[model samples]
Target: MIDSSANSPIVRLVGVEKKLGRQKVLKGVNLEVRAGENMVIIGRSGGGKSVLLKHILGLMQPDAGEVWFRDQNLVKLSEEQLVPLRKETGMLFQNGALFDSLTVGENVAFPLRERGNVNDAEIRSEVTRALKIVDLPNQEHKWPSELSGGMRKRVALARAAIARPALMLYDEPTSGLDPVVSDSINKLMVRLGEELNMTSVIVTHDMVSAREVGDRIAMLYEGKIYIVGEPRDVIESQDPIVHRFVNGISDASDAIF
Candidate 1:
């Protein structure tokens, strides 16, 4: 699924727009993430950050414009046709979607077994590797209910990465974890890009996470990417809104005092 030698943007969103009922969730989003790049997006709550992630995952389609994977336009593909493309992109949801009925190994094995035709021995081997990658190799036989919040997140990460996707989309990957655990996840993200050469798109509220893992940072405000560049550049910008948003300046730029 991943060929590092192939160059070009692995994922691109061109003039994309989406609406939910009477509300507009995204307005003409245009962005591109190149191969093996780590792009982090930051935005206030309810600012359509989550909605935009869903669009790329094809969990929801845009009402207007295109979501592309290099040359393949995802918007035009049927459910069956999109399967292979999806397999190349792994999504770590905000809430780890673990099957409570299954053990940690089974949960990690879920995607592989459902979407792949691997043999039983290979499946077990892959499951062990995934757990080891997350530093949870000992939790293989434990149920979801037995794990802590951080452990659950690690399990989700393991599952998303088990297939060794070309692209990894993380939705609040470090949300519920402590500073130490969050820092570990951040370092792992950096390693994924540097060592494994995997492209990553991360949506996060944690500014620290943004700075740690991002090769570049983009901020979404009013349903558009208001700023895009190096982490410190975007965070320390004189673009009043950028400064205000990052530093929590509450004055309304859309309104005149």
Candidate 2:
């Protein structure tokens, strides 16, 4: 939807391959995520979507191939070397992953606190701003336990974006929420991408969310990128595999177990 055709890729994966135990997860997968665009990744459960994201974050390295973030190849970087680069990115886990012991404000301030550059007043101000952006203004005193599932997610989002990372990675952000909550989260994601000037890589199974938030969608299937295109192009695809998955149509033969 956004004109990212002229933008250079902020993330690039070339012939990326990975294996867990005996299972080959990624097979020569290639993808390009342009700066300032929202890229949605969709695939079946346990289909390596999370694995692919880890590679981009340099949390996991591929058995073969290159994972490039900007001009640096993440695959070749030592953990020490990857520290600064990792700081430039934000990630929201599937479970919201908030610390039960920390208050909402403390949780959101965690990143800036770790950096140790911002003073207490600045951290408080940044926390307030991030929480406002996620639509949970003045919720600083609440504990994670006191909030609803959606609220927890919003808080986690606030924490992730507090540092204003150039890239944001989301893992099944709407997994357990109700439809209404899911829609709200999707809207917040779009708003954050615009307001923060972030390039996002979202891993999700929600077709509606994908279409609404993605400038482009890429489907990972059988250990490779099955297809990538605009929302309409992918949704209206004639390929049987894509059609079946997108339309939620199931065939008995698809069950490999």
Candidate 3:
């Protein structure tokens, strides 16, 4: 559980702005993800949700303002300087991003291998525990091609959590999943956040999953965070803009792309 009064923010974006080509994605966005809390970022399709996640990961630098992880300013760090900080964070891509050449076990164990200190015995043990956490115990030998979409997502979750990073970033974790599978994934995310004591930032448009996993929900609209509040408050919002979004009431302007 997160302490609402906690002053520590594991990640903080202050006046962040970004542009891809001529279109601006993030426009002076400011947000704070308190340590050990689950923060869900929700918005319409192509609304810069994934771009925001990339900024958090230091995979993309903001054109202006600052992105801070703990005391380190990510925007100021070089790739070499960012390595240790990157290791302290884990991310689940929207597509699972598992290597097709690797087995499930190998995939889960990739981080450990990259660290290069853990022995095979410890890697096997940690892999087993990680897989079990995702409820995929003893199925490591299977290739990515052999797994269902849901199973692939679960394996990706296992791999993301195996490192026990201080922070986790999930991009569209429940996208393309059936309702049942999405719920299961949501539960797993919550469980993993608790077990790992991680601060999580999940970028997704799924309100059900957002309500299920987020301690706080932030709605991104027109390149800004329109609101940040508890799940009930955001979902039950009376504002027309938020209401239209949360209730899926589309506007003609929303059809612009």
Candidate 4:
């Protein structure tokens, strides 16, 4: 379905296919993430979740089909064209992806520094502001090794928002965290999108995170979007893939390959 308005489609993937060597990571994937809306994509591991996020962020180019961001078809953009787009898109990696060599302040300031023209004092101020937004105001001086897993994720989150991205893409935001920590991450995901007026797309397996953060949820199954709707509707959707996935029934496509 075509959404005529540019604002209606912040991210769109049409018949997109990606392959890493001989392995096909995405097969005819069709998806959309609307502006200022939070969409959580849920599926089994290796089900093309992160692959989709990477395409949207310009971190990865698809082997076939189109990946569109706003009015630009991402597949057509060169690395230089993608640079300005990077400033509008932020990604939070699964492992928090912090630089072990840098302190929290430096990590958060890295993006702005890469853009140049800003002095150290200005970068420091922005870093502090980002940290405060994530509720870790004074941890800027600490190294990533010095923080707990949840804290590290928060620091990474601060870094992601440091540049004020128009689109925020998350790869398994609550992965490798305790239930308490996961809940905190979930809250932050929701808060960032709602409180900051951002369009977000999060790839996650945590059902709790899906329910907590998604304004709408999409189920990626066997290289296609099996279902998309409100979180409750998706869970209640009786399509085999949706039912099996929602019920945690593996060995059921026994899901078709």
Candidate 5:
């Protein structure tokens, strides 16, 4: 029972390639993320997970290959042309990436403010609603330094979703939290995806978080997607590389190594 829009993927990377300095970070990587689905990308450090996300965000263009959003080939579009597309997408960085000087409410309203059409009161109302969705009701006056790690992350997530973006990209959403906090973040992601009706792409190495939030998991290795499957399928995979990853084994002979 896949989404009817599944036939039209929201994001598709066709043989994407990128090189940074002396290393080829993405070597003909290919993937398709369907609309209204939570697609998680998992890999070791330096395996090009973030790089791939950057490509989708139009922060980077592949040296060769096409990156498509809906029907548009993003690589062919100029930066000016990509602005509307970027606005329709939201990104949660590894860090909260909030402006230290901005209050939580202001942080959530940043995007709306940038658009310059919404009045102050409307921005305030949207900010309050987004904050409430993240379960941080009436905490708009708090500063980033005053909030806990989990709260800061939730604020960041609220900011990302404030625009009601059609696509949401999360980078290592649970990177620096305790187990209980991590689970909370995981549940929040699932809930947001359901309630907002937005397609989500998460980049992380945390298997538990991936299992909890992902509808389909893609494993990046050697700058390419080595495998893509459901969480249970990934866990039970016979592929040595997947097995090694699931079991947290390090070996020279691993395919992903």
Candidate 6:
């Protein structure tokens, strides 16, 4: 396990800017995720959380500024050059994003197969190990259609971790689930990070999950990060926008024309 206490950032975004179509989504955003820490990003519905996530993944280059994964600057890397770096990262999409046609085991082994050269036995072994971590062992043969929402999510998580990447990115891992199930997912995320010793950047709107899983919380408002601090600090912030968001209050009428 890497020493998470190290001050150096595993991921850093420096003055990142992006404009999607005509909308300026990210405006000079800057943030960092230290090694092996779980950094949860919370924001309003259109606060550029996903856009920022894309920059980290090297999926979308910032129109200005830099995205750095350790010493390498992602902004300078071409798609081919970025492939090796991307191999060290795993992403769990909002909806699980599993292939409906594939069985659970196949889904988990997808990354391995794409990388090629591994024998079928090794792939199956890795899949079983990952499934056990997610607490869904012996579920290899089931189709995604046969599993409940929670089970499907576990499968997605297993798939994400099968490669044993150094970093994990989760987009709304608790979305579309019951409160109890959402809490369970939150716990699983924490367990995975601890057991695998992987750094995580979770983009979520679920305050409960954010508080429970995050080592630090970053709140994005408008087009910039309004605040970044410990979950308790972020929750107890006296700032009006932060207060309104944390308490789920809206003063939209105040902005009425």
Whole-model lDDT per candidate: 0.87, 0.95, 0.94, 0.87, 0.93, 0.92
Q: Each model's TM-score, in the order given?
A: 0.93, 0.97, 0.96, 0.93, 0.96, 0.96
Clashing pairs in 2: none
Question: Any runs in candidate 6 off by more than 4 Å, and if so which?
Answer: 1-5, 253-257
Candidate 1 Cα errors over 4 Å, as ranges: 1-7, 252-257
Over the stretch 1-257, how does candidate 3's per-residue lDDT look in tens digits?
87654558989999999999999999989999999999999998899999999999999999999999999999889999999998999999988899999999999999999989899999999999999999999999999999999999999999988989999999999999999999999999999999998989998889999999999999999999999999999999999999999999998976856
Better model by TM-score, 2 or 6? Answer: 2
User: Of the pair 1 and 3, which is ahead by lDDT?
Assistant: 3
Candidate 1 has an lDDT of 0.87
**At residue 9, what lDDT does model 4 achieve?**
81
> Model 2 compared with the native: what TM-score?
0.97
lDDT score of residue 72 within candidate 2: 99
Candidate 1, RMSD to the unseen true structure:
3.1
Q: Considering only N, C-alpha and C atoms within 3 Å, which residue pairs clash in candidate 5?
A: none
Clash tally, candidates in order: 0, 0, 0, 0, 0, 0
lDDT of 4 by residue, 1-257 (tens): 98655348889899988898788888888888889888999988888888888888888888888999889998899999999988899889888889999998899999999889999998989998888878898887899989999899999998998888989988988888999999988888778887778898988888888988998999987788878999999988878768878888887445677
Best-performing candidate as measured by lDDT: 2
Error of 2 at 65 (Å): 0.6
Candidate 6 residue lDDT tens string, 1-257: 88556667999999999999999999999899999899999998877998888899999999999999989999999999999999999999877889999999999999999989999999989999999998899999999999999899999999998888899999999899999999989999999999988999999989999999999999988788889999999999999999999888879654648
Model 4 off-target regions past 4 Å?
A: 1-7, 252-257
lDDT of 1 by residue, 1-257 (tens): 78664447888898889889898878989888878789999998888988998888888899998999868988999999888889888999888788999999999998889876799899999899888877888678999999988889889888888888889999999997999999988887777556556899999989999988998899998888888999989988999888887786677543646
Better of 2 and 6 by lDDT: 2
Quote the positional error of residue 180 for candidate 4 in Å: 1.3
